[model samples]
Target: MKFFRLIICLSIICGVGSSTYAQKNFAKEADHAFFNESYFSAIEAYKKADVKAKPAEKARINYQIGECYRLMVDPAQAETFYAKAIKLKYASTNPDVLFRMADVLKQQGNYKEAQDYYEQFLSKKPGVAEAEAGLESCKKAQVWKAEPTKHIVQNEIQLNTESYDYAPAWGDKKHETLIFSSSRPGSTGDGIDDRTGESYMDLWITTRDNKGKWGEPQILPETINTEDNEGGAYMNRKGDALYFTRCPREKKTNIGCDIFYSEPQGRSWKEATKIVLKPEGADSLSCGHPTLDRKEDYMIFASDLPGGQGGKDLWITEWDKSEKKWGTPKNLGPKINTSGDEMFPHLTDEGVLYFSSNGHVGMGGLDIFRAEETGEMQWGNVENLRYPINSSEHDYGIIFEKNSDDKRGFFTSSRPEGKGRDDLYSFNLPEIKFILEVYVKNKETQEPLAGVEITLVGSDGSQVVKTTDEEGKFIYDENGSDRYIKKETSYNIEVSKDEFLGAKSKFSTVGEENSKKYIEELFMQPASKDVVIDFPEVQYAYDKHELLVDDRINSEDSLDYLYQTLVDNPTIVIELQAHTDCRGSDKYNKALSQRRAQSCVDYLISKGIPADRMVPAGYGETTPRAPGLECETIENMATNEEKEVAHQKNRRTQFRVLSFDYKPSGSGGE
Candidate 1:
């Protein structure tokens, strides 16, 4: 299996010498331990044997120590020992030693030194894939270090622990529920994976509330998790079915992993059933990391089966929806699958495919790469996502929020500063613009209204007026070349036709952290005496006649709309109407309503609207939302909540155009 291949490599390296001793030769004993994959024991024994060995044997022992440290993920130690071995001229003539030295340097973030060693190795052994890859990685790493993308990567501290937690996927409809794999404590499995040296991996879930706070993580049901390792989970679009990887323990070693899926049954999952990829029954190889396109017609997974280009190749299989089976597996070809492992495939809804690859040149281990499909089964334009998304550590398995449009996502990484061995990270491109797509329609007929004038007044004092097309649509980035909206800015939008009452709204991107395209459907009402436009409900402190400054902020939607309308219709005169709830006496409420209406008029006057073009009117409790309910009756009979609702409905402010015949002082008479 691919998981065991690394141990196998260490075991096969550094040949042991035959020697006679009443106490067995320490060098032979160390080599024996290395062959059996007891790396820690092998390192201790090798140190003891080095002091007793000859000069050449001592150098070989040092090289073995470097390999052990490299496997243990101690790049600093690996680089130190590899340098000592090189300085002592132990296996100095071999290209493998040069390659190992370069690999360790790259992992240690010494790109310049790694590049020289890789070039030397390639010169000695031309056409070596790994050497070529290492060279390319160094060059790209330098370039990325100089010019990096503006992506903010954050560690999800609340969701992580001092253990491996990674491979995040959206688990529910709202994209707020998160499902990931963790090898932390409280996992169902009691056994540990030798490859990870932690508890067996299991699927866990957490949820984000409406306030964007994440809840505590919980283990998946027993039906899906067993006394073996199970992880790399992904849910279908519906969130009803789950597909994951399962590697059961056989004796002391892990049987090769296979992909399995479970369907939800009430609150728990049904027993998992293996999705047989090949008819050959596992093939003593591993298969995991499953991903599907938006339509779920085709599936891609990582496998170490024969007839592949290299280590673990990405293979695709089509789902037979009618036959309820999968088609024959096909490799992604040389374009994607490299001599090194290419795993953790993620296909975004936008049709781009992203996967982690060691076969391709990267900063260090398994940098993420994206490929766009050029033809059927043909992926091209493979570009590395670059640092700091890719670092001198293993980073892979990215999953985006369902409809975040490539702006934000969750990915797994083993980079330093992580809470555990492998932790989940949230990443997003910080530079984003607001996208507004407006649809104009007639409020009465519910039909599209064309040729409507759409005006947008930005908080930055910039303004743009656009006409809706024949389809009553106006897309801000129609040609995908220009953008009209900006981040951290708010805009007051007004939609109007020649003979229609204007519609208004306030769209804000002020606190939005993600880039999203907002589709707003605005309706315009026909201009008539019966037409009345109401903005969002505004509240005033009890028994306060003065309009607070905070209330002005709340009324910006109404104020801006009225301001824009006045500008659009310079000759129009309007009346501001205010009403009061059935809470106070009619005499007092009527006086309060009149004061509220006067305050609205005062606000418009301060904004430079001509005072002669406006009028204020007050309707007391007699004109409540519930016309028959009186203040005293309601106060004596209704519940507190019901009274408040009734009060909210009646205590409102609205406006209506009184006349369109008012002309400016110097304008021609109408």
Candidate 2:
């Protein structure tokens, strides 16, 4: 009877224990599947284990199921299981669970509540860098300023869905065709994600019609798109060269997510090539999100290779045209890079840089920040792109729209009500403020002259407006204001008055200080008497006394001076004479000189000079200082240069007060 009983016990133990062993194996398999990022397989395995696992083990299995749902983007079910796990007090008390909770709250737009949980998690696990960052970001969100409602306007290019349609770059200023990355359907490949069973990300193209309307987005050519993820593209100004990022299946090859380039041939992009810039043995870690300076001589990008401060950092590389390669990459240093990731760089035409960083205080996960490119490869202090522009979620990929009418821009965000993880947004910048001032004054007294009409001229020679304010101030909109004072532009400012001399001042806006303020003084000197104008000795070609147009007196100052002198010396009779150099025939010289002298007399007569009082004569070469010494050969003279100088000295014009004494014929002759 004892032998029978012992055999029965052994049989029972073997049967029951075998069943338990099988269940344990199944549980182990489920946990392993989850750890390997096999979310679908892990979900099935965890479901099978949930029914037979112990209370504590059941809670852990349920949490794993929630993680799988989270990874698969089934946030609703993920939150359900997470809540169950928390209630069961399974190790769901960990910071990871709180982080997921905060993510769910953020998705629901309960930023205030999400921020509290994020802070709690950080307080519990102060050493977790990512958690600490998230906590600080949450606190920032509470005080962050939203963009003012009245100043911003939604642009016309609405995305198909709120999915991440951002990182927009154009090959040219026209912005007719655009290339961006999207995880939307109809990709080049239909492969399932090992993690989420979703289609892999790929590049897409969308073109704008002649009317400026965007067409449906299409996947990139198979040559550029693969089963792997392709993103962050930028094309050269000419649209001939393409640069983008490609992350293959393997991540350990140092070439993980490296930059690639291709050239356009007609309608297609040629075979893509990897850009190799690292030395031998050094890992070619991520080099992506490239931005070319206007000249294309340099590029700024982000990388996580060795020698960086920590995590990923912004870097710059000079393009060597002769070598057809990029030089060694230089780290952007602390100003741009932080202990956290700094990526997705966008530079405006004016050299303002926009990037995303979690290191700086922001509303939430990786806020968009802007910094001026203060130096060559150096950036100024980073400023957080405040409020609604950023939120308690990741915001980045800020880009200025090409040829936008409103000075608008585009950016990406993961805020709620978006189609998916991220969505594109369009916004117009605030209007820039400027002032224009003009100061007018009497030229002689330097006193501010009022009632003088001042007209500001535009580049097209059209008058922009007239200034009549008491202070002589005028304000113009940005479009018309820049034309008034921009370099390479000429403005015709005309100041006129009844009694004051009407004067026109030509000014170049180029290099003029910011105010666009122009100050000009006009002199209204008392109009004076008729006068004989004296011109400096002007030399002419040998035996040629024809007065060139330029050689004649036409300046207003000279005319005015002549008029004044005539009015002051009323009774004076003047003689106008001409002389020539001692190189030509006396008769030829005499004739030429007489003609020149007559030309001056004729001009004075036209200016109301009495022809009789102004006598004209020519002395020819006979009036040389050293009488009878004439220069024969240029070489025979002491120094050819001296001979030429002496010859020029002989050419001159002289005026004499022939007689200052005169009697008025109207009364009596004396």
Worst 10 residues of 2 by lDDT: 5-14
Tens-digit per-residue lDDT, 1-670, candidate 1 = 1123221121112123223222447777777656544455567778889887887788888888888767656667778888888888864565577788898888767899999888878888989878987998888898997888778899999998888787787888679899888878888977444333556667899998888889999999999989776777778888877988876645434256778999999999999998888548644567787888777788898888778998888899999988998887898899998888888888877678899888887898778899998897668788999988888777888887766678788897777788876789999886676789999999878899999989989898889899999999898863256568877888998887766767777789899877789888988766565667676554566776455447345654456667777776776788888888866688998999889888888878888999988898888676765554556656775588877776678888877777767877888865
Error of 2 at 105 (Å): 3.5
Q: In candidate 2, which residue pairs get closer than 3 Å at backbone N, Cα or C atoms, i.e. clash?
A: 145-387, 162-419, 163-422, 164-422, 487-510, 529-563, 529-567, 530-566, 530-567, 531-566
Question: What's the residue-level lDDT of 526 in candidate 1?
Answer: 66
Q: Over all chains combined, what TM-score does candidate 2 have?
A: 0.56
Clash count (model 1, backbone only): 0
- C-alpha TM-scores of all predictions: 0.62, 0.56
lDDT tens readout by residue for model 2, 496-534: 554343455566655543344455544432211232224
Give each model's whole-structure lDDT.
0.77, 0.63
Leading candidate by lDDT? 1
